[model samples]
Target: MTIVNLDHMSTNQLLPEVQKAMIEAVKKNYGNPSSQNAGGEETLGMIEKARASVAGLINCENKKEVVFTSGGTESINHGIKGVAFANTDRGKHIVTTNIEHNAVSKSIKRLSQLGYTVTSVSVNDKGMVDPADIAKAITDETILVSVMHSNNEIGTIQPIEEIAKITQEKKIILHSDAVDSVGVVPIDVQKLGVDLLSFASSTYYGPTGVGGLYVRRGVRIWPIMDGGIQEHNKRAGTENIFGIIGMGVAADLAGKNMDKRINHLKNISNFLVKELPNYIDEYHLNGDPAKGLPNLVSFAIKYIEGESIVLMLEDDGYRASTRSACATGSLRASHVLMSIGLDHADAQGTLVVTSGMENTKDDIIGFLRALKNIVKTLRDISPLYRKNQ
Candidate 1:
């Protein structure tokens, strides 16, 4: 059976270009980036080239501003904690939204534990953050404002540029987790006015476990880990040579095919948004449909458990996910969904559909068919569904 994979937000298949690039690096470039030998020189060149690729993809003014990290989580951790610690002399407060990924929200929460005040601003029902609300949240003690460029769960895009203007006017550091937006949409640090930006390679079909943090030139950030001088003393360790090369190739591919991919993702997501509602009894779109990521289509279906629908669809050769955060065999409703004012029950029933390079129109049709059948079967025996009638 042909399997339809729409869980792109979790992870994406490595693109062929990325795979080939990594393979070449593994077979030929085995030297450490810090070495001064010939092999190391070659590897260093490759790393720099990949850095340029990443910098070009984001339209960053300085390639040196890009520091490679282990992945999105590390980038976010460093971005949030780094800026907060570095700028504490200015203030001990950081501001962000409640709908951010676990990386951003949790990191900020950790800071709040360290006696730094972190104010998590709420989003509107559409999962969109109002710039006015952000402006109101800022105060004299606000040292850094970390916001996500796009949400991982609901795929809602935020106005980082507008938020940046406010932070800039206040001379506060602004960090944006652009992990979900890097390859899908255009990103320019200058245009966004973000002091620090975090991104992941997997989001762009690169190898997993390799990402980067863009620190605007002259922005002070304290290194989270200390050891060697790798990553310019920001992150210390032996770099993942193969992963970096894969990310570079992936960045090149994403830059070249961005428009085409965007159009494809939009078509796939648009079809689902328009057609999937027709199959479900009661559902509500969870994000700003008018202005959001084209690769995502999320909705909360009433009464039926989303996990059940996902399992049934999986049995039918379709793979998807829900907003429910599964941990240690227990399913917790997504903070993202709840932040948008969804009740616990509704949040548990939220289905998250994401499109990527591997998807096509045919895949979308197959997924819809399987989804319709699964939702019907699950609702037929659902105790909540029966009682709600």
Candidate 2:
């Protein structure tokens, strides 16, 4: 049995080029980037080269705007908490959407515990947040508006550009958790007009445990980590040199191949959407397909639990996810699904399929075929399906 990874959202396969770069980095045994020596200077040069590549990937003019961190979670935490703490004099109110990842949701939740206030805007049935709704949520006390570039679970792309305009006019700092969208889609920080954007390397075939935060030149964000003045004084800690090198390579490749990758992913995504109805009944698609990420498809299958299907599919050599990997082990139905008006049963029945550059249309068909069998077996034993039937 050949195992195919359909859970690209959880993590992506490291590209060979990135792996090679990382291996070379480890072999060199480089010194600290901050030290004033030949070894340090050489290491610093490499870091800057990688930074330039990553900066080019996002179209950031100044490479100094990008700060390396542990991963997407750290980038998010740094961006949200840093901004909240630094701008306390201006205001303590923040705005966000209801369906954010745990990083954003919990970061703001922690702020709320610290006496800061938050207004979480709601999304429509298709999981897209309205820019007007975000505009209405801002107030004189609202210091920041944090929205995600695209949702990981449902793949609904938000209108960050429109929201940026609103925040700019109001002078509120706009931070977007772009972990799922940055490298997967065509992202231009200038075009998006966001003050801060958080992203992960694994989203684009880079090494895990590596990511970066893009802080617009003049953004007022404090350092989350207090120590050495690393990451342009935005983040502290010894850099993950090996992982950063891999991420830089991955970012460069992603920028060059984004168009080809998107077209391939769209072909697979379209195949999945077109073929799913033929194989199963009593199901609905989540997210706005026309406006969503081209690489992901979320399906809410009725009367069957998603985990059972995921496990059975894994046994049959296909790998997928029920929800965000970050939210794993939680028994509650997904807050994202609930935010989009899905009932508990439907929320528990969702299967998220995120494709990568390697996945093909045939892979989608094969997965759907296996899914048909699994859904049938599960539904046959489901009391809810029997009652409905």
Model 2 Cα lDDT, one tens digit per residue, 40-61: 9999889999999999999996
lDDT of each: 0.86, 0.93
Q: Cα deviation in Å at residue 375, candidate 2? A: 0.8
Global fold similarity of model 2 (TM-score): 0.99
Residue 233 error for model 1, in Å?
2.1
Residue-pair clashes per candidate, as listed? 0, 0
Cα lDDT tens digits, model 1, 1-389, are 76778888878999877887788777784788799898888888899999999999998998889999999899999999998888888889888998888888889889989999978899999888999888999999998898899987788999898998998898888999999899988888888899999999998899888999999988889999999999778899988889988998999999999999998898888888878866666888988765899898889988888888888888899888885232214567888889999999888888889888778888878888877888788888889989988
lDDT of 2 at 286: 94
Give the clashing residue pairs of candidate 1, or none: none
**Candidate 1 residue-wise lDDT at 189:** 84
Pairs that collide in candidate 2 are none
Winner by lDDT: 2
Model 2 deviation from the true structure expressed as Cα RMSD, one decimal place: 0.8
